[model samples]
Target: MAKNSGRSRTGRGASTEPARKPLWRRIVRGVLVWGAALSLLGAIFLGTAVFFTMRELPDYTTLMKSQTGQMIVVRDRDGRELVSLGPSYGKWLSYADIPPIMAKALVSVEDRRFYDHPGIDALGLARAVYVSLTTDRRARATSTITQQLARNIFLNNSRSWTRKAREAVLALALERKFGKDQILELYLNKVYFGGGAYGVDAASRKFFGHPGTELSTAEAAIIAGLVKAPSNYSPTADVEAAIGRGRVVLGLMVRENVISQSEADEIDFSKVTVAKEKGQDSVRYFTDWALPQLDMLLPENKEPIEVWTTLDRRMQDAATKAIDGNAPKGTQGALVSLDRDGAVLAMVGGTDYVNSNYNRATSALRQPGSAWKLFVYLAALEAGYKPDDRVVDEPVTIDGWSPKNDGRNFAGEIDVRTAFAYSKNTIAAQLGNEVGFGTVAAMARRFGITTQINTKPAMVLGTSEVRLVDMTRAFAAVSAGGTSVEPYGILKVTTTSGELLYEHKSAQGQVLVPRYVAAGITDLLQTAVATGTGRAAQIGRPVAGKTGTTSSNKDGWFLGFSSGITTGVWMGRDDARPVGGLSGGHAPARAFAQYMRVAVARRPVEPFDTELKLPDWQLEPDDEQLQGEPGEYSYYDENGNLVHPDGVPGQDELPRYEDGSVGPGPGPGGVPPGVPIAPDYGPPGAAPPAANRELLDRATGRSVDDPGLRPGQGAVIPVPRVTPIPRATLRPPAGQQP
Candidate 1:
């Protein structure tokens, strides 16, 4: 009876102790049960949400059919993009064309489970969720390559839960519709790689100057790193930061076993050469000039096409440097270079195209200044004026208008060759008068000067306005041995799909000037460069050109050519104001020389086709003249002054015939007959000698021998001794005036 009672008491005590358990234990058990219930409900909710998201998603076919904007690319002769017009859409590259390393690097860095996952990686998502829950931070991205592609192609970059859900659904759809390789190719060809580049192919070309198939491991890694944030990792914008990102990619590549550790280490990031972002604005000048001709070249309904131009990238760069380096501040300039066939190799329309889109090279109709003299001289050559034909360079008036030299100083008795070389305005004006202004204008038109020219005498000095391209084309005609050239920029235009739209078949034109005439003109121009105003433009090779400065120094020009290429450079104010007295010889000529040196560096040296031909008088007299022949001896000093063989009169002195005799005879000092001598001799206050007085009357057209002299005029007395007098003090005989 006692043992039974003890057992009952022990049992009662144990039950009472259990009923007195800690409060914390009961609270934890209740909370866990509630947490389990909530978790189960959340799972159901998520599953339902994903199902609805997938149902509402667009068809994969619809997504694939969506097209982006098209591009109109302008490639150089070598198929390099000089300028790309329209939207930035790169050419579609297939999976086979992309380098395998590029794909491996992208997968290693962007998504490690790219091939195994069906749009989403369950393990990656679980890891991301576990990390977020443990650290109490925002969830990290576990987006697979497929999900990122979906977000890129189908959805906007919004961080909302709805967008994320949509991205996952679209990614699953993409995986179901396309193979792994196809999706990757789509990603590569669709991703934005900054700097207006749209695809990996474009990005590769933009940053590496080559196609994706040629990418080295380092280059592939560099491009893969740009996927995260293109602008931040652009090699051209910040090379060091870009290289740092590239190293990270290479490290990731090694860890993923996509590349060996040794391979990553062997990569020299410093050796990677990033192609500079081409200045679209800089090449717009050429495009602007070339666009208008596209319609004429192709049919009206032509599709988007690629225009292959004649531009040589190297020459264009050289031309730009030449013009920008030499052009003065606050002034504008233009440069145009063309081949012998009239293919424009380089065209710089203005100094800064961003500041002004006005293409000065082809559009600006500024005065060509002395460049117009080319046609005038060309006309004179056609009119049978020998290069050595002498013309008086003294002051003259025509219709009460006078044209003065640059310094208002005249060079007396200059031949046509020397006159053109020295750019003597007076001689050009006289020749223009003699050849008829209409004839000169016609010659200019025939030489490819389409601009309207004023028939006035001032036109000989290039007062009329003309386009730089027109002048360049005209100069190209001379370089081509008188064949007219119509400057063209487009070489061919073809559709992106390889359909031929338009092709340039160089049209042959008639020869406006005779080949011999062009050659003769070329000879004179060569002399101009050797010893005349265009001396500054010599490029160590045979070059012929002209230098022209307009009145008031408003415009300056240097139009010249090599055997294969002809270029024209012009400098002046846009407002037609003086360019601070910058003459053609100072800046324009220098710029021409600078450009031609680099442009023709690869071409062989060539000389002018014709040799210089001088007149009989210009040749050195033979031994007979050395014997002091009465009427055959004459010589000119450096200053072009006529002197006796004995050298009595220096360059500063003038020889005068006595009594102003109009007949050819040997007078004192063996002075040649029909030559007028200085009448004003000795000091300013001194009187003329009796023989000099009669000679002065004959020179004034008052002698009986003078046709204009009075009918009853008596003949002069015996001839007086010849004397040397100062050239400045020598006056035209009384009846003779310049």
Candidate 2:
């Protein structure tokens, strides 16, 4: 019984004790399982990177020889380089011809262990991490030359580790496909070297004016330094900074033992020809305008070609200076100048192309204000109206819309020519209604106004939106003796070998108006420049232009031309807000004068048209002796005081009509003592209309030009009101009859 109990106790103790666990199962198996899980995660990550980075790699072979990658050079009319677009590349350099020292310099600075790394430099990464941990300076991480090439060729420089992993995978792929030297060759040929130069060959040519094959140690170091921060290290940006970077590169080369310290010190960076950064070319305004038209001219021609344009660099500079100096701040200004043949000589789109690239000259559409009167007068001339004919400047309603003069200062019974020169809004409205509004729109369209013209009474005051180019082009037609012209920029497109691709053929649009009509128009415009609203636009020469100020001064424009040259200037806010006290004769006309002075300085002073009665330059009548003034063009001076041209007699010098029909002068603040500005024909052989009889009876018991006339007064909206003056009765009031 004792033995049985002892055995049972031992058995129970043995059963109670657990089996001894194996150390291999507890540690090795667990480690293997965790390692497998980690490996699976890494596989998934690598697979995703491969799919994203390698999904569609560019055909590098095709890119190497692609015409699309070639640069196009644009030349001014003088054959000087205006701009260069597309990838700037030089001669393709193979690895065999590359200098060992050049490669060493780049390797020393950009990638120290470039040759030893399989694809990614782990040692470099570890060293970078160690430096980061130990010092305030942080070394560059894992973007080796190969990795940079991969990213440059296939991936974007997105600031993320995800992109880094993709860059790493691409680097591995590139290394597997190309040998180290071949990889270096591709990298040297594809990397951006700043200043719009891409690749080592271009960089070498840009910085040294020599090919990559002729690079010296200093130049090579300078080029190598650009890989990190091209703009910062570019000698063009700051020569001192660039040379310092080059010195650092040289030091790195010396440390790598690729070159001795003496050899590094012997390098002179002073001789390095740093390319100038094209910060902003005022000519860029013209180039920007012309570049896009190239695609349309030769859509199929993509080879590297030289575009010889019609831009006169002199005029471009003048235009830019005029706009920058004169245009008020917060207001955008634009100018366009055309040669006699309608070749665009100069264009200033805005104050600075760098700040705002919007080409206001061609793109912006705004109201032309009184400048729209050109079309009104042209339409009237086409409808058998003569400049010297009599036209009453009186307020009448069109569908209950009444047109008022600039300051309600209507010159009643003035000659058509005088009224037009004065920019009498009521007369213009009368003429617009006399000739159908559709006729005015047709005239505008015939003269290159491609915008939609609203054929309404309001069209007379230029309520329609029109581009500056449209106005310039329209005026160019008048400058061309009425033959319409299409403004052209690209004169010819030829390859470097002089292979003709495209040449501008003078496709004259059409003869918009007769030469006599053009001469009459010139006569009126000259009068305007002489004693009218555009007096500020005169530049000691025979210049003719119209001034247009929109209601509320939202837009100001001066479209004028001299012999063989026509230009347009516009000043306004882009948002269509009012420029306080803005007038077409103010900033816009001043800018026009400034630009045109330079543009015409060298050219001979010529009349607008030899046959046209241009303003008599010698007519300097004494202001006191200038008696019986029929009318005068008026404008507000810089001081905001309403004034007239020098020696242009005011209302006090007013004359009387011969037909005994007298009313008021066109001077500011209507004067109504009954002074006739021109000879009036006897009243029309018909009873006067209700409105006409009332106005005529009040104007001068003389009578109406046409009692049946219902010439609608085209209202310029938001007219500035005038002070009401006490009317002097035509007949003596009850006892004062003359």
Candidate 3:
């Protein structure tokens, strides 16, 4: 009974011990089961991620063909590079050629374990997550250098989950495809380093004034630090901030054993010198002018292209020098030169394109003043008038408006050629009226004056405004024997692969003006240049042009042309105020002369074609007519005596034609007005017989050689005489004359 009680107590005591096992063993068993299950879940998640990432990955072939940016190279007509516009990326450096310091600085500051990682750093990521959890801070980026390169080369920078996943996938694929050196080389080249510089080489040159391979430790660190915040830490833009960031890089390099602490301490950020921004390139004006035309020229092209232009570098330099040397202070100027085919050889829009981009050469409508007289005289030539036709330069009023000459004085009975040479405003106005204002306007349009013109009589004095290019084109038409030409700059366009995109060809069209008329006008303009207002524009060669000064001297213009080139120059203040009395015959003409001397130095002097025929009336009036009254009605005999209706010497003559007269009557030779005078019809020194003259007049219904007639008998009508008449009396019945 005792033994049984002891056994029962022992069993109870053992059972009461609560099955005690080692505490560590129990905990180990539970941890093992849970850990295994979690590991399985992790494995599945990683496998699935790899699957999706690989599926979204771009083919390596596509990646190889992709470009980070497009490049546009503009070359001059001679195939010389004028300017390069785009994200400037210097020559690509191979991995081996990259400076060791550059790579060291990049790796130390960006990713210390760049070589050891696949695409993501496991230890770094864990630390980032742990800091976020414990310190209540958001997780920091743990992207490896490879990841950054992948994103920069192929992906958009977005913070969305999808973009991040794609970036990670692309990064892993990049790492798998490229070795560590290849990845680093691409990162160094593909990264943006601010200031329109892309890649290490360009950044080094831009910020340090040196090439990438020659960068020192400090320079390398300075550039490397910019990758984090390029604009905020640009060495040229924010030196202090950039130095601060660079110090951080130096300290990191020290920590990574890339440099000794002493070496970093001895570095002086203050002594670092960055390259100065270069002066604005002169070609920027041309590029700015050409940019808007790109869309129309290459609407379907999304890739970059090269444009070959017709800009003659030598001529451009000459024009620029001319403008700079001649433009008065506080005033702006523009110059445009075109070849005979109307290709823009040189175009200078302003004295300084950096200060202003307003391309006055192609834009900026200013009144052309007397330079516009070319069209007026051209209209006159088309209106059966000859260059030698006599015109009264006396002040004349039309519809209550009187236009005066530039000198405010008139020379009586000047020939058309002499009047034009002097830029006679009164004669131009008179001719404008005689030919009709509408006819003058139409003639100007035919000459390629695309601007709106006023029909008022003052338009003969260039009251209307026109662009320099359009005006230059007009003059070029005259230079080209009246053929119309559209000015062009771009000669051709080609892709980087040498594919032809566009080529400029001259447009075909009928001549805008008759060759004879152009030749006649050219002759008159040449006379002007030779002895008149444009005398300052003589270039030791045969050149023709017109000088124009607007009212009050607000705008000055000298538009001239050589046998092979036509150039137009304008000077004025932007505010439209007077240029302190700078006339077109002064600075504008001087600049034109200066440019033309250089432009035509190699070309031969070519005189204008002047073999055109002239009408009998336009021939030099008989020596006696030179002494006639300035009035339009006066006629003179061969002996310088005023002639009368009876062909007798007298001071006053009867009206040449009467009111409502249809034909002229016998006076001198008795030839009708419309009848063509035979080349040798009359004796040189003797008057025709009266009986023969009377017979000729009866046969032709009028006298062709008649200089005067009764009030109602001739084709030439006098100004109607205003005789005072009594007021009309009202009559009580119709048909009653009061």
Candidates in order, TM-scores: namely 0.65, 0.65, 0.70
**What does the lDDT read for residue 156 in candidate 2?**
80
Cα lDDT tens digits, model 1, 1-738, are 445556554454545343556889878988999889999997787667656666765664454334355457899889987776654545567789888999999999999989998888988999888888899787786688889888877788898999887788778767766789988988887777777776787788788988777889989899999988999999999999899999999999999998898878889988999887777554789889987898787777423468899999898888988889988888888899999898889989989998998888988888777778898898877655667655778786654559888778998876788988988888788777665555566677778777666655577888778899999889899988888888898999887667788889988967877666788799888889999999999999999999988877888899999868999999888898877868898899999999999899999999888643433223224533454433334445334446553434543455444564333334566756444443434444332222234443343222223221111112222211222122333233345332
Would you give me the overall lDDT of model 2? Answer: 0.76
Alpha-carbon RMSD, candidate 2: 15.7
Model 3, 346-444: lDDT tens digits are 888888988888888888999999998888888778655677666677777765679878878978767788998999998888777665555566667
Please give the lDDT score at residue 205 for candidate 2. Answer: 69
List residue ranges in candidate 2 displaced over 4 A. 1-63, 66-75, 79-87, 90-104, 107-187, 204-217, 229-241, 252-260, 268-276, 280-288, 300-308, 492-502, 610-738
Whole-model lDDT values for every prediction: 0.77, 0.76, 0.76
How many clashing pairs in candidate 3?
8
Check candidate 1 and list the clashing pairs: 656-677, 699-733, 699-735, 699-736, 700-733, 700-734, 700-735, 701-735
Worst 10 residues of 2 by lDDT: 722-731
Name the candidate that leads on TM-score: 3
What stretches of model 1 exceed 4 Å from their correct place? 1-93, 108-176, 214-218, 247-288, 295-308, 328-330, 350-358, 380-390, 411-414, 433-439, 493-502, 516-520, 540-542, 601-738
Cα error of candidate 1 at position 634, Å:
43
Residue 726's lDDT within candidate 2 is 16
